[model samples]
Target: MPALKSVTDATFVDEVLLAAGPVLVDFWAPWCRPCRAVSPVVEQFAARNRGKITVVKLNADENRETTGTYGVKTIPTLMLFRSCREVSSIVGAPSRKALEAKLREML
Candidate 1:
């Protein structure tokens, strides 16, 4: 299974923006219930799309800079970045099928 790499304000630029392929960034906080709820779905999506896209998590609480830059006002926000720009975003904890459908559209 592919594991989600944790990205911080310091590494966000290189890890997400400069990545060679599409990246799915999960902006979450440890204390967020919704974030916890969506964790498994995100993990499953990452594992299934391992070679097609890169998946990373950014703690909104700890990575304030990147969170602010992206205007992430909510936890469990999923952003799809392509060619250094945000191509799509999902702001809530969506079901596996819903999330996959949305991401498939974006990809």
Candidate 2:
């Protein structure tokens, strides 16, 4: 699997907003069971679509600024960004097939 990078509030702009292509930001927290459950699926999706998209993980507990700015009320939020704006989002732990289908449709 491709290594998923970690993003912080300080790096959010350079990493996601100004990225050359689409970015998949996985907003999660370490203590959140749902977040842990979906992590592998997210990583696998990233690996399969490596060159087509950039995937990053943002810890909701650690990055309050970006989390608040994005209004991420729930853990395991998957946000897709293109041209510095969010185009799609998934709010919870979805099955691999479900996640893939949703992302495929968006991409």
Candidate 3:
């Protein structure tokens, strides 16, 4: 299974913006219960779409710049970035299947 890569404020541009395929940025905080609930679903999506899409996790508490710039007011927001631009997002804990369905629309 493909693992989730951690991204920091410093590496956000290089990791997400520069990526060729769609990048799913999981903006989450460690203390968020909903974020913890969504973690596994994000991981499974990463593994399933290993080559087609790149999944990266950013801790909102640690990486304030990227999180704040994106206007993420929620802890478990999943933003879909394509060609260095924001395409769409889901802002809560969602089942793996549901997440994948919405992500497929982005792809």
| Most lDDT-accurate candidate | 2
Sort every candidate by lDDT, greatest first.
2, 1, 3
Off by over 4 Å in 1: none
Better of 1 and 3 by TM-score: 1
Question: What residue pairs are clashing in model 3?
Answer: none
What is the Å distance of residue 28 in model 1 from its true position? 0.3
Minimum summed lDDT over a 10-residue window in model 3 is located at 98-107
What value does the lDDT take at residue 34 in candidate 1? Answer: 90
lDDT for each residue of candidate 1 in 1-107, tens digit (9 for 90 to 100):
65589999999999999999999999999899999988888888788778999989999999999999999998899999999999889998877788778867765
- Native-referenced Cα lDDT, model 2: 0.92
* Model 3 global lDDT (CA atoms, 0 to 1): 0.87
lDDT of each: 0.89, 0.92, 0.87
Tens digits of lDDT, candidate 2, 1-107? 65589999999999999999999999999899999888988888888888999999999999999999999999899999999999999999878889778878767
Preferred candidate (lDDT higher): 2 or 3: 2
Best by TM-score: 2
- TM-score for predicted model 1 compared with the true structure: 0.92
Give the residue spans of candidate 3 off by over 4 A: 95-97
